[model samples]
Target: MADREDKNAENVAGKFYVDSQCIDCDLCRETAPKNFTRADDEGYSFVYKQPESDEEREQCIEAMEGCPVEAIGNDGED
Candidate 1:
């Protein structure tokens, strides 16, 4: 489970976030390109945007479901 307290600094202020447990995987980026991104220099992923539509929201959920380390969080404030 992702620790909100340890969420990545690059994540925007939103319900979706990536915590320090992220392993720099690209699955979230591939699954929700509009909402997730990577900082190659930092070797981590973060939520760059919040979902704006039902489809986007589902995609973000999929990304979180597919995450191997459960680094993605969707319960934070918007």
Candidate 2:
């Protein structure tokens, strides 16, 4: 059960959630395509996968750093 929960959370990916604070800047997608994607309807960015490679992990960290609104993080736990 705990493993399942962890998997579910990993599937959701990232520590950040796009909120009303998002400006649809697409920076996250640009920084990490494998991890972040644009939502079709909302045009906001979301994490598609937890980064597996060093490069990808760096990309996600960069996306978080580059967020204009600082909307990205470990779901505010950071």
Candidate 3:
């Protein structure tokens, strides 16, 4: 599970975030390109935008579920 305390600083203030456990995988990026992005220097993924629509929300959820390291978290502000 992703630790909110350890969430990446690059992540915007939102429900979806990526923690330190992230392994630089492209899964979230591929699954939710609009909401998630790569921190090239850090080699980790972080949530850049909160979902603005049902489709975007679903995509973020899919990315969270597909994360192999369980680095994605959604228990945040709505």
Q: Which candidate is the best by lDDT?
A: 3
lDDT of 3 at 16: 88
**Candidate 3 TM-score, C-alpha based:** 0.96
Clashes of each: 0, 3, 0
Supply the global lDDT for candidate 2. 0.62
| Candidate order (lDDT) | 3, 1, 2
RMSD of 3: 0.7
TM-score for candidate 1, please give it. Answer: 0.95
Task: Return the clash pairs for model 1, or none.
Answer: none
Task: Pick out the ten consecutive residues of candidate 1 with the lowest summed lDDT.
Answer: 69-78
Local distance difference test, each candidate: 0.92, 0.62, 0.93
**Which ten contiguous residues of candidate 3 have the minimum total lDDT?**
69-78
lDDT string for model 2 (12-74, tens) is 644444444556798988888888776667656666676778898788788878888765655
Alpha carbon RMSD to native, model 2: 7.1
lDDT for model 3, please.
0.93
**Stretches of candidate 3 exceeding 4 Å from the true structure:** none
Instruction: Judging by TM-score against the true structure, name the best candidate.
Output: 3
